[model samples]
Target: MTRTWTIAGSLSVEPATQRTDLLAEPVAKALAALENHREEAGVAPIDPELADTAAFCEAYGSPLAASANCVVVSGKRAGEVRYAAAMVLATTRADVNNVIKRRLDVRKASFAPMAEAVELTGMEYGGITPVGLPEGWPILVDKAVAEAPELVVGSGIRGSKLLVSGALLASLPGAEVVEDLGKV
Candidate 1:
């Protein structure tokens, strides 16, 4: 299927392969691994100062709905911590207290500490995307995110962003499309 991109604003992007240097190690490797699958990923370098989703969206003119945020949540079971990455539209928040906690079978589910999330994911705090998360971590992709035609996600670093097919994200290994994973 021919892919259509909805990039706006003044951001200039190139094929993901040519921009690996701009991404974190895990993210670069993940991009390489997806090469055989015909993943059409693109990278756009931006000012680190504008790496946050809202800032990036405003600076690049990408619609907020087309921007997806990846958040790391953790819960404890029998003193063991379980981590999961949740992907939701920028316009909504992940249902951590209810849906996620229930799904995880834990009494409580909360966002992981910044240090823990960054260190474990090997990605920057604001750039912790599901693309390169640690093995065995469930990647919960909200239905809306999986259905978007195009999406702008983190590059695993604060210096750039990744533009890819939403379908591609849903197909990532360990990705589970969950309905109502996000809430207004």
Candidate 2:
């Protein structure tokens, strides 16, 4: 399948390949797992220092609206802990206090601690994405995200970013498109 890249000035994106040497282990594994779906996904190398959404968008000339942020949220219910990955546009914030907490059927929901999120997902802080999250964890994609043509997201590490189709992201194994999942 031919992959389309909507890269900004001077940024080059290439098909995501099984390149463990180039990416973090979890990222490489996630890309490999996505092969079965035959979806078009690309990886663009970036300066690790500019991996944060705002910095990355500025450095790469990418629009903040086209960049998605994946946040890990956790809640407890019946003495059991539940985790979920929320994908929202950079312009908005995940409605963790309301939507997510309600969805998880827990009294409260909050962003997972950076160390816990990193350890659980095997991804670096500031670079945890929904694509390679642990099984049984739901991936909640905001309606806007699911409707976008394309988006830039984390690649499980700070050294690169993944460019993917929004529709494809919504179709991931555990993804669910939720209306009003994000709030300004």
Candidate 3:
């Protein structure tokens, strides 16, 4: 199957490697994430009412049960290398102290600023994906997120988003499905 990932102006039609959910690898992966909801094609609601993560899901007519994949700020004073990838329910936050903080062995871990996050991933802060990240970043995904029928991840760059399955995310390049990631 040929998957065509629509970008800002052009389209990406990669050869069939994994299931071609879309022409782009990211879109394909995103489509793959929606395996549980196979009947419903997990396409980004192009005309999103809002830009925030929650707004996207809600606008797409989702049950608001979608998870937001983010690069969390961790370690004392934040901005530390302890940057981790975390996916939490749109309704819940990560448990930092009891989970990621101790797990990363940091004195404190707060959210890294959007500017910093964007800088690190070479992608817009809101569009960071787990598949392609700078080396040595931590991925602390919530176990509950992986169990989700369909989770929303990044599309490499922010121009678009990927709605993939938790199982698919677990099998992604650098994704580490864990329940230890924390939220504030």
TM-score per model over all chains = 0.94, 0.93, 0.66
**lDDT of every model, 2 decimals:** 0.86, 0.85, 0.55
- Residue-by-residue lDDT tens digits, candidate 2, 1-184: 5566665445677776733554567767766787454347777888999999999999989999899999999999999999999999999999999999999999989999999999999998877888878988999999999998888998888988888777868978789999999999
Cand. 3 TM to true fold: 0.66
Tens-digit lDDT track for model 3 on 23-123?
24444444445434333323342432344666655554444556466655556535445677666766677776567776677887777787877676666
Q: Number of clashing pairs, model 1?
A: 0
The C-alpha stretches of model 1 lying farther than 4 A from their native spots are 1-4, 35-38
Better of 2 and 3 by TM-score: 2
Superposed Cα deviation of residue 52, candidate 1 (Å): 0.9
Task: Name the runs in model 3 displaced over 4 angstroms.
Answer: 1-49, 76-80, 180-184
lDDT for position 134 in model 1:
92
What lDDT tens digits, residue by residue, belong to model 1 across residues 62-153?
A: 88888999999999999999999999999999999988898788889999999999999999988778887898888999999999878899
lDDT of 2: 0.85
lDDT of candidate 1 vs native?
0.86
